[model samples]
Target: MSADLIYLVLGLALLLAVVLPIALSRCAVSAPIVLVGVGAVIGLLPFDKYGLDPVSQQAFTEHLAELTVIVALMGVGLALDRPLSLLRPRSWRGWSLTWRLLLIAMPLSIAGVALLGWWVMGLAPAAALLLGAALAPTDPVLASDVQVEGPSVTDDHDEIEESDQVRFALTSEAGLNDGLAFPFVYAAILLATAGPVAEWGLKWVGWYVIAKIAIGVIIGVVGGWLLGKIAFRSARESLAVARRGEPLLALGALLAVYGLAEVAQGYGFLAVFAAAMTLRSQERGHEYHETMHSMIERLEQILTLMVLLLLGIALTNGLLAALTWPGVLVGLALVFVVRPLAGWVALRVGHRSEPIGVAERWAIALFGVRGVGSVYYLAYAEGQAVFPELRELWSTMAFTIIVSVLVHGIFATPVMRRLERIRAAAA
Candidate 1:
């Protein structure tokens, strides 16, 4: 209870937060799970005398998770080295994964959630839609663990030129889709408030879907282009900034674009990501790519640790109090069944790489690791809707996210190790 003891405790936690992640890096375990476990154990003790009131400020928990998610998005955007394109040769193979994730997997996932909401959970249609949208976007922070290492694997000029197909696509997709999933959440809110589907049908569809998506895209392209040009070439010493390797300029671009887009009512997530991609494309062969990526990645890792620890605190404090058995079953189904089936269908189109064959593809799909982003969306949606099922939905989403982090985190390193050996043998 003394100030000195409090400071000591804080210092110890901070140390664990840093060291545990590095120590667990190549193992099948993850920093998030460990932090959560520690927090839970600490909570179980009679620590109320320590004066840490975890329940009074749920808002703090939500905002911390939100900040962590957005910052991770910025880092994800900054790490992408490939130029944007619809064509396969010019894009990351993860691009196909992104496309399939959005076009097929996303919609199907939403529909599946909605159906379960209606039949099993007995949730209202609007509440069902909200749950769907909230759970849809895969969290970039957690995916970063399983994602391929940096944009350039080989230092060789010829080999380094080959775009990192998997990481780029997954990072970019997670960045943009977080915002794209918002319109659906908004639509659910509108439908909940307004009368029925037929009444506001075309009008609501146009405004939320067409108008919002358009505004987000336009703001992204224009804002990103302007910021990229400024960050990369506005000064008289334009080439000097580039030559000096100032990667913090990337952070400036992220804040500027995200802030401006939010002010204009466009999706800030889309804008931040678009700006990063545009900047990367400006000098695709620049040596500074790794410099910028390394800096952002470090910051992202720290933020991830803090967020996961807080999430663990919340779980210990009673985040799952309202969870039901059916809800638990639904969450498991999403992880094991829906995601794998979707990944299989998406990759069924085929790939040029044999190492990432059908079996590998299935593994990737099955491990659709959810984490902070899902937590943010669910919390944000709860503020928007208070349906009878809202509490249950929150519990289920939290349960699913925790399960995914533990299961996938435990297996990612081992599985990736195996896959790499397999690829090497085949080669």
Candidate 2:
């Protein structure tokens, strides 16, 4: 708990973060799997007094997870190799996978989990809805293994260069859904506070679902375009940060667009991601995009390390004390049933529209790893409205994240390797 001890622990964790990625690259184990196990082991030491409790440290938890999620959003947005332009109808073809996952799978998963929460777990309606919304999105931070790598500049700016198709689908879905989940979370809050759908359903639909999403997307697209102009296409030479090699401009743009969107009452998560994608789209073949992505990726990794360690420590130190059989069942159901089934259904529906074979379909469905984004949503909601089953919700969400990390981490390598062979055979 001392400053020195905290520093010492972080110093060691930082070392592991740097080493583990390369060390575990060829193995089934992931860096997160190792870091979390280490944190759980560390929790067994006399540091019980030092572990941060999520209940007492709710504000810190919300903000820390908030920062981590946004940083990850920026990283993923920049990492995407596929070009997307809302203004161009042609651009939407390459992104059909992302759209299907976001639209069909996400809602179905949310509904399935909400039903499970209400009927099976006997959670209150509002609490059940909150549970569903919070866990719906696939996390970008902890899902790096299943996502596209950073940008690689090519000679053809107009060329439609793709990351691995499965990785691209997963990455783009993770990038966009964090923002998309906000409407459901707000509906849950309204249900809890406003008493009934008769009183607040219209308001939720108009503002939360329609207006906010439009505002976020419009502002993000316009703001990102202006920022891109300043960086890469400005009239004045000094205004072009891209030419000057200022990678930190990614951070500046991230904060600027996020603040702008939130102040305008739009979804900041959506704004951040939209802006990053817009920026990346500006100079498709520029080395500047890679520089910015690398910077964000490094920062994202450190923040993730801090969080995973705290979560693991919390796990052994009473975080799960409130966990019950219902909560356990809900957690298991989410990883094993809700996500996979929902995703498979969505992919199947889109099979005629796009030729995603069985293996790629399964990979995309099963690899929606849940992590810090869910934590952020839960913490943010707790700050906004009171939930009677807050303790149990925390336990279930934590348990689900740990399960996701364990299962996905153990299988990602072999699965991805097999997919690569499949791609080779098809080619």
Candidate 3:
């Protein structure tokens, strides 16, 4: 592309970023849908462009998706109004929902999808496992409509009625599970490279699961605590920086913590999110949280637009050309069956005492919209090891994401609004 054309495209993207949120707010339409549609249309135009093959541009695709997810995670952590606690009955709801989704629902979803991919879609065991792990997490970027708004001064812990249970559940799940899914991804890589082994099992459990998770948590807590002191409760001589009210500090913190975690062989996703949560917990009612969240949110929005637009272009350019009837069935089953069933089982097992209504549980289960994160995992895995069924994997993931964006985006606003009304009446 020429400089003039590149400048034109950039200008148009900025305009859409400024206008689309306000325009889409009046209807059930979502910004993702619009951005994707525009990209598809542009792809059909007669402009000579570079191809967007995922395998060929693996690094670019992986890093772009990685950056978007980290920013979204930071925004999610900062926006949460509820405090994390283990106290029974009163303060345990958030932690309970998060644990169920991560421990029970996520593993079940991975196993179910892997089985379907192997049996129904004729994928190899390793490839099937990769697909399952990649699609496991509900996307943090494209789920904005279902997430809580930024920190509010009036948010109170005692007023449980003011909380949106569905949003809270989805947001917290997305925030944590993005990091949690990495171990499984690594497992798939191990199986592909080393095959099944007795010795590898012990190493995987100890190093991958126990050590990495512990490292991520420790770094996040200590890093967040130190940064919080610097940003909020600095000594008298260093208070001027805190008084400056610069939100870019949040971005710096995100990069710093994520880099440190990755260098330490820990999951950057967990560390970034944990750090954000710890920072938020330091001053729950502080106005600074809003500023930091808004900054990250805007950056995430821009990055999401770029990614989805490229995805649409890729779709139009034959990313799904290898899709078969069985692939389509597998994708549909994942959205309509696997996630909902796994989510139901997890909630039933974990929340036996404080049962959620059937409708609410189903609503939460049904809305696991997969987006950029899936693409990132696939690209990352493909870079790690060659998969003969690469096209099939991409086709299934693309089909599921397309269906999810349309189905979930259309229903999210109305469903959430109706749920809020029901809760209000009951209160």
User: Cα lDDT of all candidates, in order?
Assistant: 0.68, 0.89, 0.83
Q: Candidate 2's residue-wise lDDT over 34-53, tens digit each?
A: 88888788777775386467
Residue 138 Cα positional deviation in candidate 3, in Å, after optimal superposition:
0.7
Q: Which stretches of candidate 2 lie over 4 Å from their true place?
A: 1-5, 235-237
lDDT of 2 at 243: 90
Rank by TM-score, highest first.
2, 3, 1
lDDT of 3 at 307: 83
Q: Which stretches of candidate 3 lie over 4 Å from their true place?
A: 1-9, 85-93, 154-162, 236-240
User: Could you give candidate 1's per-residue lDDT for residues 251-297 as a string of tens digits?
Assistant: 66667777777787777777776666666665555666667777777
After best superposition, candidate 3 residue 120: deviation in angstroms? 0.9
- Decide which is better by TM-score, 1 or 3: 3
| Number of backbone collisions per candidate | 0, 0, 0
Q: Each prediction's TM-score against the native?
A: 0.87, 0.97, 0.94
Task: Estimate the overall C-alpha local distance difference test score of candidate 1.
Answer: 0.68
Model 2: how far is 427 from its true place, Å? 1.4
